[model samples]
Target chain A: MKKKILVIGAGSDVAQALSRLRAERGHILWLTARSQEALQPLLADLKVRYQVEALGFVYDAELHSAEDLMAQLPGIPDEVHVAMGYLGNPDRLDDPKDAARILKVNFSAAVLLMNAVMHAMIEKQVKGVLVGISSVAGERGRKSNFLYGAAKAGFSTYLDGLRNAGFSHGIHVMTVKPGFIRSKMTAGLPLPGPLTASPQQVASAIIKGMKKGRGTVYVLPVWSLIMLLIRNIPDVVFKRLNL
Target chain B: MGTPMSALTKISNWGNYPRIEADVRPWPLQTESPQIARGMGRCYGDSALSTHIVDTRSLNHFLDFDAESGLLTVEAGLTFDEILQVCVPRGWFLPVTPGTRFVTAGGALASDVHGKNHHAEGSFSDHVRWFDLLTASGEICRCSRTENTELFYLTLGGMGLTGIIKALAFYLKPIETAYIRQHTLRCENLDETMAGLEAYGHWTNSVAWLDCMAGGRAFGRSILMLGESAKQSELTQAQSLNPLKVHSTKGIPFPIDMPSFTLNRFTVQAFNQVYFHKHPKGSRDSVVHYEPFYYPLDKVLGWNRIYGKRGFTQYQLVIPHADARKGLQEVLELLAKRKMSSFLTVLKIFGEQSENYLRFPKAGFTLTLDFGISASLWPFLNELDGVVERYGGRLYLTKDVRMNPDFFRRTYPMAQEFMEKIKALDPTGKFQSLQSQRLGIHA
Candidate 1:
């Protein structure tokens, strides 16, 4: 079965992995990312390795409007995967501009993109899949990365409500919560080695989770239990912790 | 889809050693510059690694098929696994296949890969008909033996420096059964092993597993396997009914990386001893599918993980028939003196060299061995490379990561010719990879 899929934030490690796996399954990809230039190597490799057609477009998610972006799609994607993220220095969020950019990039922009794509699929009367990769940090606020976590938390909750809205319309909305990953996005970070996942593993989990129609997934499954334990701690004790 | 994102990421080849945080470039070019094409990441070393590359696996698809002619035209990204899934049921099979099914067609051609049948059939390129190449100029040139003959020969095993392979056309050997009539023999020394292989080399396919840990008179103790495609008439009544059907073994993957200490010399030597003694000196013919006969290791998926997080290095070198004995003996003695042994070591005899300017095979004997990554690995491989140079034998570029540039140039006389092709076609030298940079093959 050849699927026509749209992948946004295609330069991200997890997103690239997802696109690679989908292409192996014989899907035609339409990719959009912050920089089309950055996508050249990946698209070239995809072309030579999978022998599948993949078209790339320049799309910046920080736009205040998505009408122009939606207008550029070849057609409504059979499935949509959104993997855009902005993990800024947490301490720098004290600056109002930095904080606003973080929330806009991580929260509202995703909400807008999903809202538009979901409606487009609905208008077409297509029973399509919509997946957005969030993070386990969103399960609870943390002192080290609370701003990004809060934004992800908002995005996760938004997906939950979208899932509610999508059910009657026959659209599947899935929220993926990944733990630590050693992607290009997290290179050089002080992340514990054992806790990190490769982009392929995360991508595999996303495909498996979407196929299973999991509403909100903790990738690797164990993360779900791990988050549960973290979320259950009282704020009194949590506020003192720096993890 | 809405966020500010950066562009670098960490990636590694099959070995999982020296993971690099590098930039990635995807095509439908936003920039006029060219990037290297990488398919399936199956190479055991950095031959396929680079700062940025075109992920060719996404392009795998069958472009055209002639059922009657048994000719297949597939995009470079297509894999033999997928090819067999379709062809085997139709009484067709790949002309050649490596031990793993995951390698992309582009990677196969780029390496000019040889299978267990090399002694009978040649490498993969010998069976190729034509291919559409996306050259450095962005022109789609049709290349074949009779058309663009020079480019065709060079690109067959050009390691993708020639350009991205858009599509390849090749002949598929017709088959009446998916099973192989197999014969196995156990030999107790290098002389016995060589004799056993020669005796069975007349079969369609032959391969030998050597006990690298054995020393003294038992130095090359091995299990020699020979097989022929079981003919329809050769099958039993029940087997004849399902002759054309091919079933893959459902593999159990290694769940997690094993600890590095698990595959040290002590364990490999013990295992090698037991394996050597397991089969008594004799021959047996058995009926089996192509899966076990051609790719026994595929039964356990992610078998590489057994080498652990640091990964292992595979040194596969070939020496000419004239110096086969002396060259192999030198290399084996080096490993024995180091008290180091490999878990997997294979020996095969080549039939003839490939026309592909950069293809590695010649009329020779090739030995492939794997050693887990350790502090002493790189230095040891250098010493081995020095020995290979003395015998005029060459290491397989596809399995190389640490070979010296001097050794590569000395072993592959085509370096000058291949460089000329790159200079003429890609004047700017836009296509690149770590291997090219390491060997200084491209500007």
Candidate 2:
């Protein structure tokens, strides 16, 4: 069955990979990125490569209201994937404005946007799958990126609640916790080879998880084990060690 | 917008020679001048390396594809592998491709790479309709035959010195199936091999694997492989069901770098002997998937590692048709005399030369030999370069790491003209590579 899918933050690496995978399956795409110029190429690519209908709209999570953005979609999507994220500089925590921006973009904006989409899906009685791309950093906050991790933690908690709430409504919400993705966000980081997953790997995992109706998914299975081990570490020991 | 991150990293091309530490960063959305653009770093030498390199892999995106005319538009960073994955299933194939499908379209244009079918088709640029080049002044110029004609011609095989290729439009040839009807002929010697290549010139694609180590009686003994796109009717019942199936098998990974001593002359000779005898004499016909036919080495991921950590260089040179026979024999004789063994040796005939200023392909017999890096290799190759130049042949810029400026200028008659045009286009010397600097090509 072909799906009508909506991808938020279409400019993101994981989202672009996901969109391509979905388009390859002959799904209709409605994409939203901060810049329509950035989204145009992907839209055209999906349209031509897969002969699928793809539409793009300008949407800045910080600037635009979720209600206004949701209103722009032609139809209620069968699946909605939120891939927007900002890996702000941990060194720049001295500036509260930058810290707030990261928190809002990764957590507040994502929550409001998903809330709007969820309401729209409920109003239309569409039993859609909502996928939130959270991060493994949220599993246990470390000194390296506790600020961004905290924001993702909030987003992950929100998705967990949404998953329970949507269960009664016949809607499925999946939380994706990816570890060390090889994307623009982590381009320069010295990520461990065995631990890092490419955007394509994460995208395919999301699709597979969506198909199996999984509540939560770790893009790389080992990430779940790694996060579990990290979570179980005593605060005294974890605080003494640098992650 | 925040400043993009940059890392001081050690980088080298496929040959892995003369590795240097440079500041490498992703191409900025709004790029500034004076930075060299690199995609996949597949160029054999310094052509893709510079002090400051802008990685274009992030810029990969498909812009458009007109299914009716088979015209596909893609960003510069898109690889042939990515294109084939999408296009082949739809019965469309690249008009021209090099031995490996890992090369980016922009890199292909910059090098003007030739394929097995060069005698039938042409270089990669021959099929290019037009391209959007980000000039030194940050102006995006649409270049083609008529528009910005000189820039268009210069940009092809220009080594990305003229500017960064942003996007390009090229025509894709429609294919009935993905499988190739292959015919192989085992030749006894150089005379027989050359004759075989000419006799099978009518075939859509042709290439020969020559055993350079085989001396005297077996000198230039080779197997000529000819291919034509297999028709649906020619495929077996199992294959006919999915005639357009693209190869999805993962290549066997070359897990570790072999020790330097592992690929010495004796081992290479033994391998070559085994390879040569594997194909039966006379004509043998078979159906093969395009992957193995077009890119046999790609099956061994990081096969270059077989040369070990010191790395190796592929010396690919082409001599004009009139002098080709003598030139090739002289080169092969030198290799045999020196007891220098090149593990992989290939011979092909290119039909006609494109007018593109710096493109390597010409109407000639082109031979490629890969030599592992050794103490004597550098000076030995220099001697070989002299022999090649004497025969009115030129080395492939894409494969070259150490051709002196004088040799480059003498061999490429249009080097001066290319320099003048580039100077006018990029007066500030904004777009230059280590290759351009080494060859004395500057704005």
Candidate 3:
């Protein structure tokens, strides 16, 4: 069945790929972002290049719950994708207001919006799927970016519980733990190709994981084995070595 | 029909085995209700709380047996007892036997049960060849890893929520006799148990019983048991025979539900001490009966009755193998500090990756404890749930009755896929259970 889909972070590279994949799959799509006007050229190109039913809505995960965003829509789409994430500089989060702002936008707001959409799908018992973009840094806290890690950790755990809550119901929850992504999220960071995934690779992997009913997935399957090795590093050595 | 909820009908535990203060009335069977499977009643909670619990005891009939291939086909309701009745006599046995034999074939498949040998053979789901599932639409479809693979995976450890299992076919393990060649190793503490079991896993089917009540120096101390089926030649002339099954004759019914204070620490400690001592020294070599070895608790017809009218709960959790020793220490330390004495506590080693993302048993160390019901228990269990979450571990749904939605989700991340598959099958959600509702599985 061709689904009426909505991409929440339309301009993001991952979001664009997801939009492309769904569009190619013949889904009727409505893409949303912080600047629909900014995304107009991309939107027009998408309609022309992908030939998908496409449109765009402006959204700020900081300001609006997904339901409010969807409420603005002509009607609800079959599935919603939250491709928004911020690996903000933890060092700059020293100011109390700054830290709280990061927490609100990065963690609280995203959770609220995603959950609102989840509540609707679950209550309607609709055959809907919700995918949250999370990072492997959320697996365990690190001194480098514990704040961002904490936010992703909370979001990842929320997605996990949401999955369990929707089990007997029709709702589906997925926790995507991409090891390292080459996107605005990690633009200039020097990352080894073997350890990192491109935005397109991540989007494809996430779709595959959701289709397989995988509860938790590492974007690069190799991360499963890699994480296994990291998880077993004993505390004595782990405490001394800084990753 | 809903279990008649009378003020008199106070239930604290979900196991068919009894504790102190309660009476277990069999749930009335209804034909019109969707097809159903019966669990061992060991589900400590509500995984088996279905509208129509097909009291699998009636379906305990073996349909066919291939002696050479060790493949046995039987009615879904067949229990481990019936399998042993036929297989033990003919040098064959079910590939995997969970802690208790009281569970039915459908029950085992529904829960995707794991046993002491899980590290070696995976779970019961791995051995199952195929099954006849009675879907909500009333279609009897054959599913296995090959046919209807999705249904097969979903049904395995699917918690009987997917469909009513009618009959199942699985390969059996060839056994020399009904006896097991046992080995006993005493670990001074939990870490040693992990090390000892891992070192010996390749050579044996293993399990351990921890001394949860023992505090301080003895905290996390346990006895590790590693064994494989004994060869037929290992049985002596006296052990070579079979005895007629004698049903428990005495019905020691709890005339009246006892007060909650009845199963206090004093009585529980006494029971724990006796249970711990009964295992004898470090180890002993003897030809033990399959009934005693596999299903000792089943001998007591109404064992759960001992817990009184207010039932108890079984809290089981699995920590990643790397952190098992530390996690087990924390759990035991907490239980000891609480002074909660449980009579039955079992520990098993798990290897191989957990297949079902949301299903409970995985590659790690799993701890199972039977605790008497107390008002403080839920809060305490919730606290333990937090501990499990920190370690990225989860509780077994089959044994869980009190985990909240957040805790449950943190525990089983793959629940979404199972949810989707089930939704695809039953859109209207006609097949519903109290557990699915309580855990928000069908909210």
**Isolated chain A: TM-score per model?**
0.95, 0.97, 0.91
- Model 2's alpha-carbon lDDT is 0.89
DockQ for model 3? 0.01
Q: Write down the RMSD of all candidates, one decimal each.
A: 7.2, 2.4, 26.6
For candidate 2, lDDT tens digit of each residue in A66-129?
9889778888899999999998877565889878988988999999999998998899999999
Query: CA lDDT of each candidate?
Result: 0.82, 0.89, 0.71
Ranking by lDDT: 2, 1, 3
lDDT for B44 in candidate 1 is 83
lDDT of 1: 0.82
Tens-place lDDT digits, model 1, residues B100-149: 88888888998888998898999999989999898888898999999999
Question: Which regions of candidate 3 deviate over 4 angstroms?
Answer: A1-243, B1-13, B16-36, B39-42, B51-58, B241-262, B274-282
lDDT of 1 by residue, A1-243 (tens): 777898888878788889879987889998887776566656754664467888887778775356677898888888999888888767554588778877887888889999999999999998999998888888888877788999999999999999999999999999988888866556435565666788889999888888788887776667778888999999999888867
lDDT of 1 at A172: 96
Ranking by TM-score: 2, 1, 3
DockQ of each: 0.06, 0.38, 0.01
Q: Candidate 1 i-RMS (Å)?
A: 9.0
Candidate 2: which pairs clash? none
- Per-model TM-score of chain B: 0.96, 0.97, 0.87
* Stronger candidate by DockQ (1 vs 3): 1
- Best by the DockQ measure: 2
